[model samples]
Target: MEQSKTNQFNVLAEKPVGSLLMQYAIPAIVAMAASSVYNIIDGIFIGQGVGAEAIMGLALTGPLMSLTAAFGAMVGVGAATLMSVKLGQKDYGTAQKILGNVVIMNLTLGIVLGLLLLVFINPILRFFGASDVTLPYARNFMSIILVGNVVTHMYLGLNALLRSTNRPQKAMCATIGTVVLNCILAPIFIFVLGWGIRGAATATIMAQMIMLTWQLRLFSNKDELIHLNRSIIKLDVKIVKESLLVGLPQFLINLCACLVAAMMTRSLTTYGGDMAVGAFGICNRFILFIVMVVIGLNQGMQPIAGYNFGARRYDRVLGVLNKALIFGSVITLTGFVIGVFFPTPFVSVFAKDSPQLIKMSAHALSCMVMMFPIVGIQIVSTAFFQSIGYAPKSIFLSLTRQLIFLVPAIFILPHLYADPLEGLWHAAPVADGLASVLAITLLVLQVKKFKKQMQAPVENMHTPL
Candidate 1:
């Protein structure tokens, strides 16, 4: 195990930056892309098998889902970030302890929150923009999902830890495994068994539970550097604080996403009605897939940047950052061109029979991605801060896009426009453009800071030491 750890460090710390990124990023990209496809497929199935309002129901659940992930990310991202740095510093024992704490945290938070959500499901959905037409579908779907929330949290948190511990391939496999299984089972449950929207949610949680079983077996192996152990299973206050501090950025990002989603959904409900919210769902899936690919790039960069930063290898950290930023830009740009030229085809995949749905979704898709390319820089810069343990900056960057820019745009843009929904559609690109500018400013300052640290005296470099 020690020898294995040493080899992992040598590769992460000394390998050619480009080659290492390719090795790490491809699996991660594939995994994130697959996860994105899982969502797109869900929209397709629900739109076709259930109805347009079912899609609206599914869309209304977006905020609640984001809230669920917010809690999971709080522990998962924090522990993974800490583990990356600890591994870079050669503190394997503490890293392992963090692994145990992550499990405890996920399990505890998942079950408690899941039960609470179940109790307050209806009121919550109503507040999240569920209407009379969509409330039943949302209620049925959310009930199943909340009941299995622990499985979802455990699987997702463990996957993040897997990547941090030099097991990106395993993490990739787990995600792809769920994607494939969900693809097969979703149709059967929805169409064959006639389970309606609940079938889609059921397929989702079941897939997560199965993949989680695989992850648990891998973590149970005592040969692994970070594995289940009785000694570290109990939570420590210090570890908990550190994990929450580091993870809070991602948690808040998702929390803010939930807030933004609720606002958008409510706005769509008020102005455009259920069908309009359904259109937003289709556009969101396409945009999310693009964003997920960028997240894949960020995941690829995280451990490399975190590890090298901890080892005082500032050049490698910067190298990884530069490459990730460029790659993220390319991904978003591709989405831009496609969104501009092929909006109809993209929206049609979700609602071929509904012309109004297609028209609204196509408009949303084009307007929402007008400044898409800049978004790559924003996302990568936020991840860069989180990777280097600059939690406050990361949190600020994350919130800037969702709360600082997007939320206000959603509200104000509508009143400024003759057609209120047009403003809502335009809000996304406005947020993207503003957030990208903020990212550039903050990242420029951070790069200068990195350079100074690079030039510092041997003992003065900011490192885990």
Candidate 2:
């Protein structure tokens, strides 16, 4: 398909949204899954080479990393949502203003937050459940991530706009470049140079720099649609407000996930030990990977949903959601089943000589995989709610799995069991199961309402005159 003109309104109007969406989604999904390789590589290299403590060491930074990344994603998703709606409405000038504001906001925010992180990282790590043994490794790793936070922020935040513009392959290429670079450099730094945790962080920064460089090149291309002209390069109050309306729901969701990671860290440390934290860290990484399929659908459908709704094409939105939900269900079945029935193979991929990590990870991964289908439904439903501007519904559905359901379980489950540590391991999966049920119920009701509205008889023009 040829690209549309920068100011064109007929882009989506010319084709079925599903047709355009499929062209974009396959690559977007691949991009996210490829990006997951970065984590998998980091785990394999560090877990095997530096030992289980290395996994715990890096895991120490997971929540804080999540918090910072959540803010970055919030800005990106908010801006992209607004931009897509504007594009759908054929308001090119307003769309440009939004593009400018997103760039300004994310970069400025990234720099400010990065500096603060650099200053207080050690203190934050201790607060996140780091022990004397894990402190050095965590601090070194975090300090490096903070130093390059700006690059990571821009690459991720700006990449959202690429997808919103229906340029999925470009987005995928950007991620591929970074992950490939990271994979190559990680082993060199970790084993060849003997840099340990610091090496992993350094390797990540190296990859991020490559990604950032590629992203900047895209903005500079003169032939591009929606090129960043200097005239519209300032914040617009109206666009910012609208963007926040869509974006804040997702922002809150990510922020809640960060809270979940933090709370998991604190609780795992108390009931289990460094080993449990290590196991939890490994479990969560795989969880994120498994969920990426549903995430791919949510992300791919978000712009399509928002755009279709903006164009008042209500039925198109419903159609997109239908296909996406079915796809998400299939992906959930594949990833979760493998993690459940064949835990040894999956964990063995990231495992080394640590029998403790293997046992603990197998136990944790099996429990976590139990709720996969439900969580898949929750993920897609939350995305649907956010895409359609049901912000409160989105926020509630987003937080329930992690915060409302999981956190409370973490607190109460341990007390009920003879082995409190087993309760600790059960927190996330238990929450996932309950939350999935609630999400499914709400989704079915909402879909029925949409159907009712769609099929409601039009008022007879000349009835009973």
Candidate 3:
């Protein structure tokens, strides 16, 4: 076990930046992409099997889902990041403690939030632009999802830990397994059992539970470097503070996303009605597919950057960042080309029978991706700051796209345009373009600081002393 642990550390420290990224990023990218694909598939099933209103209902649930993910990312992303840095510093004890705290925090938050959301589910959905027609489908889907929220939280928290603990492949496999399982069970539940939207939700939670079980078993192995210990399972004050502080940016991003989704849904509901909201939902799923790929790249970059930064390898940290930026740019640009030119085909996949839905979705998708070519830079830069323990910068950057720019654009844009829906569709690209500029500025400043840090030792070596 000791030798195995040493080798893992050595690889992170010694591996070439490009190869290391491929080793790490590919699994994560595969996992994220597969997860997104599953979402697209689930959307297809709901749209075809349930009804168009069901699709709108699913869209209405976006805000709630984002709220759930906000809490999960707070513990999961924060702890995983802290653990990665601890391992780089050779602080195995603290890293293990982080794992334990993650379990406790996820359980506590999941239960409390789940119960609260369940109680207020109807009102919340109504606030998020659910109409009389769409309310039942949204309520049915979210009820089942909220009930199994603890499972979802634990599964996500543990997977983040797996990546930080040198088990990226394992983390990847867990996500892929869940996605595959969901795909298999969704059709059965929705079609055979005739559960409709409720069936899709049931299939999702069941798949997550199965994978969560496997994750727990893996952590139970005492031979692992960061396995669970009953003695350390209790929360530590310092660890909890650090985890939350580190995870706050992600938490805020998701929280703000919840608000933004709600705002967008309400705006769409007002201007274009329920079908407009459904169109946004379809566009969102497709955009998520692309964004998830970028996220996968960031996940791949996280440990590498975090570990090297903790080790004071400024050059390696910067190396990974540059590579990630380049890769991220390419990915988002691809999404841009496809969305701009061939959106009809993709949108048609969801609702072939509904021409209005397809046309609205296609136009919205194109508008949303108008600034995609530079979107990757903003995403990568935010993750870079977070990986290096710059929580303030990370949090600010997270807010730039969602809260600072996007929120205001969503609000003011609609009133400016004669066609309110067109204004809403344009809000995203406007935010994207502004946020990318800010990200580039911050990234340049940070890079210069790292470069100076890198040159410091060389300058000292050349001195008389």
Candidate 4:
């Protein structure tokens, strides 16, 4: 039994850094893809079930949803990275302590946030550009989503912890189970049950609830090193500080996206109407899916980098980074090609016969994906900085893309062109280009610092890797 337990850790950990990275990435990719299915399913069914108007309503709320996710990713991922390093160093006690802190933190976040969101849902949706036609739909959807916040946060946040433990298969299982449950229940809620917009949100919540149960069961069953204990809920100020130090950068990153997205939505509604909002929704959803590909690589790299860093195998971090960059570039290029060449169908795959939505979405698609390659670089760099505990660098790199670049583009690009119609569209590509430039810049600086540090003459050799 002792040997079996040892073999288990070695399973994901023992492989060459290259193969192990891919092994880790594929499961993460699948889980993310499956998660995207929830969006796709909701969009397709909502577009057909109610109408394009309702689709726009649903779309209007995307930014807030994405905003909340930033917290989950921040806390969950930050804690996971910390835990993985501890686990690798054989400090299971510290690892479990961090794990406990993460669960408590995420749980507290969801409840406080859910209540706050419930109180402010209307004003928030309005700020996001909800129109008279779309307001009801957005309200219904956002209400259910806020009410279901616990499932969404706990399910996803815990999965990151699970991933850090090297249980990618279990991680994959929980994610897939959620998607499967959503698939079965969504259509029923949307049509058969006559729940409409609320139904889509309900189905998604149910799926997440199911996934959370399965994930909880895994920890309870055995063979797991880091399990959440009832006594672990006491807030350790040190652990909280550490988790915030680790997670805040990620939180700010997503928060920036939310801010930019809100600007986009409000502008789209003001200048274009429900149609533009719907189109941008599809554009944002597609981009989210594309980002997932990069995020998967980050997920794969997180554990490897953290583990090897803990083991004092700094060379392995470089190895993982190299592989991640190459793989991420390929995925980004493929997504860009698909977005540029086949954008019409990409929109139509999720949308129905609405010509206005199709046209607007196609336009949004071409411009939205303009920075696909930058997205890949940004994700990898964020993971690299996080893995090495350069939390400030990670946070800054993550923020500059959307906050510094995208926000400026949103305002400046609209005015740069004389035509008012140009106001709405120019932000997409301009922001993409600017964000990409920022991401690449940060990445280069990090690389330079890393090289200079490692290249310095040492007792052994002076080479980095």
| Most lDDT-accurate candidate | 3
CA lDDT, candidate 3, residue 209: 98
How does candidate 1 score on lDDT?
0.91
Tens digit per residue, CA lDDT, model 4, 1-465: 645654555544467899899888899988888887677877888988888878889888888987888878778877887877776677777777887787788898988888898999989998998888899999999899899887788888889988888888788888888888888998999899999989989998988887788888876655565676776667778767777777777888778878888988887776677888888888777777877867887888888988876665556767888889888877887888888888998799666677777987887788767767656776787777887667887887777777777777777766767854456676766666665667678777766765665666554322111
Stretches of candidate 3 exceeding 4 Å from the true structure: 1-3, 457-465
Q: Between 1 and 3, whose lDDT is larger? A: 3
Could you give the C-alpha RMSD of every candidate to the true structure, in order shown?
A: 1.2, 4.0, 2.8, 2.8
**Sorted by TM-score, highest first, which candidate order results?**
1, 3, 4, 2
TM-scores, each model vs. reference: 0.98, 0.93, 0.98, 0.93
Candidate 1 stretches with Cα past 4 Å from truth are none
Model 2 CA deviation exceeding 4 Å by range: 1-11, 452-465
Q: What local lDDT score does residue 50 receive in model 2, on the 0 to 100 scale?
A: 85
Tell me, by TM-score, which candidate is best: 1
After TM-score superposition, what is the CA distance of residue 311 in candidate 1 from its true location, in Å? 0.5
Point out the worst 10-residue segment of candidate 4 by lDDT. Answer: 456-465
Worst-scoring 10-residue span by lDDT in model 3: 456-465
Q: What is the C-alpha lDDT of each candidate?
A: 0.91, 0.78, 0.93, 0.79
Superposed Cα deviation of residue 297, candidate 4 (Å): 1.5
Query: What count of clashes does model 2 give?
Result: 0
Model 2: how far residue 318 lies from native, Å: 0.3
- Model 4 misplacement above 4 A: 1-7, 10-14, 421-423, 451-465
Error of 3 at 115 (Å): 0.6
Q: Write the per-residue lDDT of candidate 3 for residues 148-240, one digit (tens) a residue.
A: 999999999999999988889999999999999999999999999999999999999999999999999999998887888798799899999
